[model samples]
Target: MGPLQIKNILQTSPENQSVTVKGWVRTKRESKNAIFIALNDGSTIHNIQAVAEPGQFSAELLSTVTTGSCLKITGQLVESQGSGQAVEVKIDDILVYGTADPESFPLQPKKHSLEFLREIAHLRPRTNTFSAILRIRHALAFAVHQYFNDGGFFYLHTPVITASDAEGAGEMFRVTTLDLNKLPRTEEGAINFKEDFFGREANLTVSGQLEGELGAMALSKIYTFGPTFRAENSNTTRHLAEFWMIEPEMAFFELEDNMNLAEDFVKKVITYALIHCKDDLNFLQNRLAEEDKNKPQNERSIPLLEKLSFVVDNPFERLTYTEAIEILLKSKPHKEKKFQYPVGWGIDLSSEHERYLVEKHFKKPVILTNYPKEIKSFYMKLDEDGKTVRAMDVLFPGIGEIIGGSQREEDYDKLLGRVKEVGIDPENLWWYLETRKFGTAPHSGFGLGFERLVLFVTGMSNIRDVIPFPRYPKSAEF
Candidate 1:
């Protein structure tokens, strides 16, 4: 028979059939007459118990089968007499594939701080917490593709390196092969980028929206799920130097259509996770509850499952940025002078402001639209009054802005003017602008940070914790 995953084996009814299970030992308890070993193979959050009689195996083998040790146990499946599980394997033979020294193994079947687990990231996946998180992460990623594919949206691969700055944020990681010690200088005493690998200048892409839009202009609907880099030296729980982005662009889609699609898309994916990753979600929910126990009542968050269900069940509260600002202005926190930053029109909304709107006022997901042009990207379509743009930010209860997007400027002259107004070199974006000149129909797209979504779903407080290998300021350790 094929190797059975622990998940399937655990689900199998006890028919007294012979089976072989291979996995790492989570914990082992030995008595005078019996030994119980909890084994997991990264298949599920739960572990399968394997029982062996004393002297059934060599003392050396039993000693080696400690915590974190790899083992293959062939046995008879029987109805479990244990309290926690339904099925247990009555082992007839045991093989030790690898052994982890009990003393050296950082994970010793105890509660570990998230901070400590991050230090040993290579082995963190073996922990119940990280394994559950990774399983849920995979479910969400799969749901992303399945959702788009079922809706006729093609998966488009965007470039990692590009000549243009998509966000124009000026926080790009420079890509060059020029010798740093021996420099190439131009006549103007500037570093000559012409001698670099790309011949002019290039850097890692910040977003795939620009290229995804190009695909949408032709393919009707396209989505890009890939890594994007930012050179900003931010050392916060929310910021990462390298992260994955999910950007979907559509042709002939106005701001309203974009909003509808985004709301539906997120709800669908979250729903998928709820259905496919029920066990992992339950584990994370319990984990979050335990973590919140030490915090003040006001500081504690809503239960993970409840928060997710609320998002999926309710229609998001939609309002303009102006309306949201009006609400914040009249809020108790604002009136009591509790806001950390000043709030008014034409100002960028901070996380506090967003949280207030979603967690306090609406108590649900909030979609704020029509942001002032000055605070948003240049490519966003301008409004008739020549001030606000048709931008939208989807705010979750815990996550400030889960998704940000806008109706792109289809007018060539207007787009060109805004491009120059923002100090972006028009010549550098000629190709993107040329789309507006030729066949650009009204298109709208949004970018969702993959790690942020995982953070929300897994109930992970730190962005670094959700991603396996987090890249941040001053740290890129494996």
Candidate 2:
């Protein structure tokens, strides 16, 4: 009949007040006289302990209410019998609307493997770890919008389907309406895939950075937050077939300005999640620390709030890609790994190299700039060396490369030349080059791997765990 949140109840002014609460049973304990149930409502991180006497509600009635069963209860909020909690509910009435059987259901008291949990993605949120992850995910999302919005950046909705692959990763999943059995044939003998959809070979966008750049050119500042697809075959936890990206584009900005945006943006995200998701973070803290009560404090102090302050207050260490390579060559951590690529001045830094730079060398998030032209995308502005591009990847302590962005090749001839050099048809990027043709103002931006950011904020290791309904390789169900 009434709505009450466990958090609100716990903070009630009148301690012994009566309240009505509705939620699903998380865990239940049976006794000869009374039955205890921990009820979890999605509104809060905490669950209310409900004590219902078997004497009043028949044993059969109590039996019907199992873990995962939905219920509404009218109860007096009294102090808890256990030392762990301050208050609990003394149930006066109970309504068991829905029930779940322990035998047939998925969740149980025992710990389930991450692989097993991935199978039941939909129901994973009810678990503590997933709940914390999703909470941090949402908090970080809001933080991203707030960070951009506070700075007067316009929120732009970029197209999900585009004829152009923004990242030029060749990882796009094509969008086609043409029937496979009945293919359209042009004068050429090749299959006319261009006949599909909007009369061209369109596919899911790999990044919205290109479109975001256009918005920035007009609005000065703009950002896009949405799903982007990558059909890359690598099946690592760091790679996802479908993922979200936050790309903030700015006009009248160059490489240094772009790095400042990224540094501030990363801090804002961490700051917001730490502030807004305190309860959820603390949940992780307690869960992780409880495993080893004697564990060192430094290793366990990973919740966003405790560590984010230091990161936000400090300026990110900036090192050129060449400098980073030099440091990696001379670094002790790299000595142990015997890096697969083996460090070289002109070589692209591997994830391992980036980790050594951020995690061991700097011991914080770092920006490595001016990568070799050969390894970077075509859109990056050319550097003075005439060999390297203006591309940069923001490497965080735990998550190596969280962002990839660069100043656009604003020179009309340079862009066209780069397009030709990259062997992509210049026609596909005609409109992109048009921005440069029509008074472009040295715009720059970067794409933060939203899942990786979420992972960083929540101290979650796997990218798959951060995204709900994760679309990893051979994984589309649950």
Candidate 3:
């Protein structure tokens, strides 16, 4: 009786039963006897073919059925005579809801570069690549919640505005309502924050981990999935000014338990995409293959589907940061001077080094633990060795660090000392310090960059392509 989605129509048996379909026209092919239209409603990547006889509609009406036109059609579902698809619709009547002028429409039935699509992000979702990617992203996100919920983790909503910088990187976007042109000066001629909204310096949160810890301390297990901001000016393909992060904090968990949870979580989300988003994944796999054909044989990657399967089927290799450093120091890349960044005991691992470990050396997902305390965040629990902290980073083949977390320092004195050692004011974090002072338990958690996961799963080269509206340095255009 009512309009049915194109995806549902494509899946049903062709019984010549009349049905109503509403969607945007993807393409139109004109033949001597009829016009064949490909309609897609964004419910699925596949399109439904609708056949219209020459006498069924006027030339004026058919002329408007170009790409991007929205239409509602009443038709009888019948077996298609085509090779690729199984069913199609024989149109009885058509109504043109809206028409897109071919002369001005940017998305034609042709191949467009990813760079060009980035410029018109608002309309890129209609394209097959982006549509498929968005579907997979949705499936992965759903799986994240399902996995955590099944594991008895409560979803925690953390504040977007706060005075504390959890990462201590100082790359924060200041949130202020004070008039810059007005005078609010102190005796020392410093800008007085007493006139500000929060009555103190506030910033867009760089992470929700600190707040998540507060919830985990009471709830035992909690996770936060929310937008995070960073003021870093880097405009690399892997960087974003604003992005989503998945952070899960668990109480009474050690470094080893943390590592296990991270590995299982990643694998579960990937497996979900494989099962639920098979059609979209197949399209993306073919898309990546076609793109790879342009690259040199040595630079080209394996099939996208195979890469995903490898992650789902295989066990991630686990090792200590010390062992990983040893392996890298003695690696062929290091010995032959191929590494751009020097690798050693205290040096932080670069993207190149991380990729080498996962793609070439280990040839699997790697969980590297026990990082040097100086290179890691101050909140990370320091090991008995007094040198390394209980930090862990999960590295994938193409994407370096997909997840980073640590067992939080629970001892009040140790945490306070480390906070001061890192040049962060302990008094500013009095509330956080009180958590340790009152009833602190050993807790562990990790933050996974959601866009990076989508990028990796979709086989997309640029991080900008995965998110719908990308925010970056000097670029926030809708």
Judged by whole-model lDDT over C-alpha atoms, candidate 2 comes out at: 0.82
Query: Per-residue lDDT of 99-153 in model 2, one digit per residue for the tens?
Result: 8887887987668777889889988888878877887788888888888899999
Q: Per-candidate TM vs. native? A: 0.99, 0.94, 0.98
Query: Each candidate's lDDT (Cα)?
Result: 0.94, 0.82, 0.93
The order of the candidates by TM-score, greatest first, is 1, 3, 2
Kindly list the per-residue Cα lDDT of model 3 for residues 1-478, writing each as its tens digit: 5567788889999999998889889999988887899999899999999998877788889999899999998989999988778999999989999999999999999999999999999999999999998988899899999999999999999999999999999999998999888959999999899889998899999899999999999999999999999999997999998999999999999999999999899888999898899899899888878888999999888788899888888789999999999999899999999999998899999999999999999889899999999999999999999999999999998889999999999999999999999999998999999999898899999999999999999999899999999999878999
- State candidate 3's TM-score: 0.98
Ranking by lDDT: 1, 3, 2
Return whichever of 2 and 3 wins on lDDT.
3
lDDT of 1 by residue, 24-124 (tens): 99999999989999999999999999999988888878889999999999999999987999999999999899999998989998999999998999999
Residue pairs of candidate 2 with colliding backbone atoms: none
Models, CA RMSD each: 1.0, 2.6, 1.2
